[model samples]
Target: MAGAFEEETNLYNRIVLGSLLPEGAWEPLPHWLQGWLRNYIGGTLVYFISSFLWCFYIYYLKRNRYIPKDAIPTNKAMLLQIAVAMKAMPFYVVLPAISEYMVEQGWTKCFASIDDVGWPTYFRNLALYLTIVEFGIYWMHRELHDIKPLYKYLHATHHIYNKQNTLSPFAGLAFHPLDGIMQALPHVMALFLVRMHFRTHIALLFIEGIWTANIHDCIHGKLWPVMGAGYHTIHHTTYRHNYGHYTIWMDWMFGTLRDPEEDEAKKM
Candidate 1:
């Protein structure tokens, strides 16, 4: 584990930071600081690039088919969402940076390589890890809505985009900094409960950016069990259903799942 961590540090310094920073500039900082910088920069890039691509494809290219002309978020709303996300991004990346540092220090169940365990065991652990994260995030998110003070303060910033028309991909991360962190804490916490590939953990964290954007697009993909924009759109409007992340399993189990299909059927 120690050897792998050292190798990773060296690789990041040489390939990532080395290409971007002067030799003397970053060499003096500690390993954790370097990891944080890497996460911050990488996360910012993922947020912008993914958000723009999703927005462009949906809002520009296929706007007529995917989004309602009257329901489209105004430019001002998108800009505000972007601004809020930018302000919270540094803090949002901190959890992953800390998780990376902790994994390096051998404090987590994060394994340096999948070779340590066979493919079957690795996948089993991954399933367990995801399960823990799903359960934790569902409850955490539900409480953010159920608790009056949490909603009034931290979570309320995101509820501004409550209606379908006001929601867009940009609204994904447009959260109060602490609110975002609290929601993301489950991913990091899962590392302690089950073994996970270090690289997989990092990849999943970044995937959250894309997943959130997809959920906010307000286009129902009709992917069952998998929580698509259709389910999430209902969550935004009703506020009392579909609190599950990644999947509807938790919400279904907990009796909070609301099928978007049922709503459409009623309209018909």
Candidate 2:
């Protein structure tokens, strides 16, 4: 009976936390602490930190965008909108609704609870969902450009950055409400489709918030210190192609991985 109880307890902890813990680190903390961290701190912290960093980066991008080096420009107005999303979005819209939805479903799972899966398996499933989410954003971004009349109203704001800055990418969020919502819609759909583990759901959302903000960094477009980026900058530079927000695979697939000829002309 004791061993059975232990297994059940371990299962609960695992499902409540899908991807937060790495493989074989610390043992699980107590339930009360887990609840506090997951419910109170994690969600708010991710949003706030991502939002503030976004503001600062945008500010930095603004000061530097005008230079002629390999650098890009940032948009001031777009920065403010990113700031607004931090407050208006998490407080007014997303968190409250997600909380309520969880209660209604009686899932007790916070965001994307993984009730039965372990580490590799959970991430494997999550990869599928994340891919789906990325595809949605890719297509939506494509529509904004491919369609003419909508371009001026929906997509032009992001193009304000001639080069690329962390700030200018999010600055485009204020462009059109549809743009922000469209970016988020995929995650929401993925959660429903897979019954994501609650906390994982929240973590993924936080990732999206930070992921979008980071790619827009005015630097050479590396999402992190590593990884491929700059493609978004290519989009801003040419104002024609390379629209994926996260990874460049889609851009490469579509034949938009920066033009050598155009890069030279812009330099000239």
Candidate 3:
């Protein structure tokens, strides 16, 4: 067990410190400090780059959008959302770092290469991870709503933008620090539950960052079985339905899924 632990530790050190840092840049740091720098700084850097790109794409390039132009949040509101996101960045950074350390310690599975695991195993693990995360967040989200105090203190900040165009990709992480952490708890938990390649972990996080923004773009359409911006938009507007993050299965199962189009037709 000790030998296996040492091998995994060495592998993580090489992948995280070796690849992410300049040659010799990490050598001078104390052992504890090396871990801190690699996990915290590296995690923050990845999230920052992903967040910036997604925000830029949505606000600048994706001009013709689902929400009408006039209904979009004003520049001031968007700026406030960005500011809140910045304040909440530390939670985002620290969680991934903690997860990485867990992986290194063998509390979670980690592979050095996708080839090591084979393509079929890699895909299965990815699916399993997503399911775990979605299941966790769905229940936690519903609990946040059911518990009045939790909703009032934690989840309310995210609901501030209750309209379509008022949300952007930036709004995705603009949650209160506690709320942000809660939403992300599933990702961390999934690491412990499933064996995954390091590359798969990174890919899942990257896709999640982009998907969070896409779901808030106010576009009305499902990504087939996967819930899309339209499904989430209704959640923002109604605050009573469509609570699952990536899939409609939970909401459908629990009877919280509301179809906006169908509701509109009934009103007419």
Alpha-carbon RMSD to native, per candidate: 1.4, 9.0, 3.5
Tens-digit per-residue lDDT, 144-228, candidate 3:
8889999999899999988866776667767888887788788888777887776557556646666776777676674567788
Two-way lDDT contest, 2 vs 3, winner = 3
Residue pairs with clashing backbones, model 3? none
Candidate 1 lDDT over 186-235, as tens digits, reads: 99999888988888888898999989999999999987789999999999
Best by lDDT: 1
Model-by-model lDDT, in order?
Answer: 0.88, 0.53, 0.74
**Runs off by more than 4 Å, candidate 1:** 22-24
Higher-TM-score candidate among 1 and 3?
1
What would the TM-scores of all predictions be? 0.95, 0.60, 0.81
Please list the residue runs of candidate 2 whose C-alpha ends up more than 4 Å from where it truly belongs after superposition: 1-48, 51-115, 164-172, 221-229, 259-268
**Cα lDDT, model 2, residue 115:** 47
In model 1, the clashing pairs are 71-165
Estimate the lDDT of model 1.
Answer: 0.88
